[model samples]
Target: MIATAREVKDRVIAALNDHDTEVVMQYFARDAVYVGPVGPAEGREQIAWYFEHLLQAFPDLQITPWCKVPACDPAVSAVSEYVMTGTHLGPLLLPGGSMLEATGQRIAVRGAGLCTIENGLIVSDRDYYDQLELFSQLGLCLPEAVA
Candidate 1:
């Protein structure tokens, strides 16, 4: 069971490196939830849309897996640590329907993901990453700079 979870976790990391819409959608359940920097996205279709936009924003995105571990229930839980490297080459849309212009900056940021699997598909996957760090790498600054 744990072995299956580990393979799923590894495949997920590999799929994230590509731009294919189907690749990103295959691991998710129909009603899966994906939590990321912006917020939680409910449903597999929503999660697929998120990845599509993300790949557009970072056309050369690559994820390097650092670690993967079985967390609980073997086939039900796994955690992954990785570094996502990419260049901002297209508009990045925000949750509230606003878009950040491409800054053409490159970022290699550390991130982690916790995934819950049911019957070999992801039911819930929460990703933890430094959004502020990503913005900083892209040279984004608020109107009022903080010291």
Candidate 2:
């Protein structure tokens, strides 16, 4: 039997918490698109790369879903609010082609996600989070503008 949207979302979350990239990729369609803080990753390969990078950066990363909106009859979508906690033990890639070295800082960031499921597989997943908040937790600061 085909899994419902909630089932798929729960399974995906479990896989992510397990830090099993391969297992997480299973719930995504071949052409799935995942848009996260960095940007949009198209296809399973790109999405897998994104997860791998995240896991490498935070080997002990944990995701806790606090709230979930019920899926309707069609069960094509799922929305959830979650918190991700981990330690910065590995290099983190920045948007401007720069890399942030490991700071050994523990971070807890709240975020939300919307998953679009098709045939029990995720076709598209968009994650929303505060980049500034993440950076602040990592002890990073933006330079003040000069007049």
Candidate 3:
């Protein structure tokens, strides 16, 4: 059976919040493109590396999807609203090129995402969140918003 874009994205989001890199990667194609605050990760390996770093930074990362908006022909594209909660316990490079050391701060932030699916596989994913809010929650200083 073929899966819908929403289904694919739902599973992907769940896997992401679980911090299971392999499960999260299954939703994307080998050559998939992922764009987030940090930058673009082109290819599965890069995506895996990104998530590995992310999980390392936030071992308790959790994402809650508030909504899913579907559009485009065949409904292969979707916009999802989400809220995230995590604790900073490891070094992480912010989107703005700043490195943050372990602050052991807990943070919760709201965000949105966009993704395009093809043949039930994620072709592209774009994530948008407020980096400033994250920094503030972490008690860290940032010159600007990371995303």
Clashing pairs in 2: none
Measured against the true structure, the TM-scores of the candidates, in listed sequence, are: 0.90, 0.96, 0.90
lDDT string, candidate 3, 40-63, tens digits: 999999989988998898999999
Model 1, range 38-95, lDDT digits (tens) per residue?
Answer: 9988997799888888999999999888887789766778888989999999999864
> What's the lDDT for residue 110 in model 3?
88
Total clashes for model 1: 0
CA deviation > 4 Å runs, candidate 2: 71-74
Q: State the lDDT of candidate 2 residue by residue for 56-131, as single tens digits.
A: 9999999999999864654888888999999999999988879999999999999998888888899989998888
The clash count for each model shown is 0, 0, 0
What order do you get sorting by TM-score, best first? Answer: 2, 3, 1
Q: Candidate 1 — what's its lDDT?
A: 0.84
Task: State the local distance difference test value for candidate 3.
Answer: 0.87
Model 3: which residue pairs collide?
A: none
Q: Which window of 10 residues has the lowest lDDT sum in candidate 1? A: 1-10
